[model samples]
Target: MKTFCGILWEGVRKELQMSFSAFFRLLLGALKSFLNAETLQCQVFTSDEENGQLESRFISLVSNDDHKFTCNKKILSSKSDVFKTLFAGSENDQCVRFQEIEKNLIKIDDVDGETLREILRYVYFDVVDQNIMDPNPNLPFKCLLAAEKYMLDQKFKDSCQDFLVLSVDDENAFDYFRLAENLNAEQLKLSVGDYISQYLTHKRDVLP
Candidate 1:
């Protein structure tokens, strides 16, 4: 009887120890991932020009101005699904984007250099200041596109959502609504609808 009790206790103790160890490991893994995602939360904004370019799995981007620059491939792939899929097929081979370049140089099409630089900065750092946005209202639209393309905005939660809603107005409210639909942002869609409804109602009341 004494021997059986001792063995039973030992087994229970071992099982509890294993469970605790596994739980601790899982907790650490989750914390690491959350920290990585939230690294730039509320940090002071910086531009690509001020901090210089980040170096991580570098890729070449040729802007519309015919200028060339290097960007961090890991950061781009992590932030943008478009980039990830672009590079996905070349797992066993060199990056497909680079191979397409005549001199083993890759270039992102359509987007200009300045715009790409701003997007990259947003990826590594955070949002550009309100001052930057004031002059170029379309800035947020581009950022929203990149965020949606990479499924990144989902990770940041309300930050992107609030920014989109705040930036909406009579001129761009519909644009935000369309973007919200594309991004599956149900909350923003509802918010955009509310804004449009109010605007139309106000306009109708003031008509001659």
Candidate 2:
């Protein structure tokens, strides 16, 4: 002979216990999923880092003269946008392996061996030798062309422009002005124009 209130209390208690049990189970399942996802992500990252260390860190560059040069991939890519683009692979691609690097050699058909050597020297040591510069007056122009092609640092191009400006004279003023215009060198072009104007003024002043 249980009362109606007693029967109702029993039903409510049972329902509350069942609800709590279900909630705890759902929480546990979600936590397990989160932990498993974290572990998988960590494993993938570790694999990529280890594989990168084992791969080739250097790349080969071939000049027009058939001379091959080996450069550190990280160093070259950091300095030049062209190298960075060349080194970067597709989004779905994996890390570059040693065999793949060996098979792919970057070619610079417009630059010769000697010019390439100088470029490499500057890339490595950040210093251009005086002997090299003095002996070859045209080296700056050649380097400027290579710098433009490879998208080297602006400081290097400016240095080349400065050297060319110092070498400008009456005989080569027009030629240098044309080269400056072709290369989009504003400072060099203005300097050459000024020099040509002065030369013309001096000649007019001394006219017979």
Candidate 3:
């Protein structure tokens, strides 16, 4: 009788183990099916029209000529002190009353379309080719104005200064010096003076 009772208990425990094993298998199968369904339901938004959906999170900048640009608020605020301060009061902010204010956009009256485009691209990706300084001679000045307007980082301002210095010639050297003085760019002012002095020395040496 003891042997039979022991055998019965063993059968009960085996059944319980098998039941739990089946239950867990079913649960895992259901979870995988749900995940597959969710994956199938998700859609990719890679096109230009799909970018408009980000308006709720992005800041809308409207140019004077009615050109519109959208930028990531977090990126701008992180990179620019001007944007950081503007967005700081957002919690109790009366100026930006609408949480999703596509209608109430930022007005960019001073910066031209092309300069603003380059600035926005730089803000997004932190890249601008130095080669552009030669073909577009006035680009540095435009960039300076945009940088000052945005109150951007020292790196960006310095990059613009470096470009101006590299592109400066006797014809544009005095103009750059004046621009440096106006913008308080000491690096560029010194660069201008050095470039002119070097040019004068070169001319004197080359004289027959």
Candidate 4:
């Protein structure tokens, strides 16, 4: 009787093991079938018009590598709220870095020099809006040179001073002075330095 009971228990255990294996195999097969059906359903249901619309929307929202003017205009116009999404309330170094990246998006086509300049001008205005002065002397110095050139071409003496004063060091300041002198903007040059100096003096006097 004991031998028979032991054999019966072994048989029941083997049956359960086989049943579990079969159950798992069936479950796996079902899952695979479901995934395959889903993929096929997606492919079969996508109409040509829907797919074309999707492609058009994607092209409009993202930068067009072939015609960069489209992308540039979109950025400048604040179209599709992409930039707003990216830089909502972001400032300082983060904003500066974003502006730099935006500058890189300007196209280098044969007749796009004005577009490039406009992008640079946008960057300049961004810096001004954030009251950012380059911590690195080199960057601000380069900016001063650019500002001087821009002012000479545009004849914007006041704007030139704004960039010149940002150069920070005496040498850069003198470089701005020379450029101003060459442009015959002596009065504007003197006024710009004096204004910045007075502002600095006031700021220092207020500091504890």
Question: Best candidate, lDDT-wise?
Answer: 2
lDDT of 1 by residue, 55-160 (tens): 2235577765666766556666777666776656545332333334653246655556655666666667755544436677566566656456445645443455
How well does candidate 1 score on lDDT at residue 145?
60
1-208 per-residue lDDT for model 3 (tens digits): 5698899999999999999999999999998865433222333568867655544446677665667776667677777776777767545343342233355377777766767777776786787766656668788779887787677887888888988877788798888888888888888988998888898899999999
What local lDDT score does residue 102 receive in model 4, on the 0 to 100 scale? Answer: 47
Tell me the tens digit of each residue's lDDT in model 2 across 1-208: 8899999999999999999999999999998866543221222335777656523565677888879887776667766777776677633222221123245566677888888888877776676655556777888888888888787877677777788888887888898889889988887888888999999999999999
Instruction: Give candidate 3 regions above 4 Å deviation.
Output: 1-56, 90-104, 199-208
Model 1 clashing-pair count? 1
The positional error of residue 178 in candidate 2, measured at the CA in angstroms, is 1.4
Q: Go through the candidates in order and give each one's C-alpha lDDT.
A: 0.65, 0.74, 0.73, 0.44
TM-score of each: 0.55, 0.64, 0.62, 0.28
Clashing residue pairs in candidate 1 (N, C-alpha, C atoms within 3 angstroms): 81-150
Tell me the tens digit of each residue's lDDT in model 4 across 1-208: 5698899999999999999999999999999865543221223326889765433222111112333332222233342232433335445342232322242342222223332333344432332322323343333334334444332233333444455555535435555556666666665478556755776788799999
Pairs clashing within candidate 2? none
Evaluate candidate 1 by giving its C-alpha RMSD to the native, one decimal: 11.1
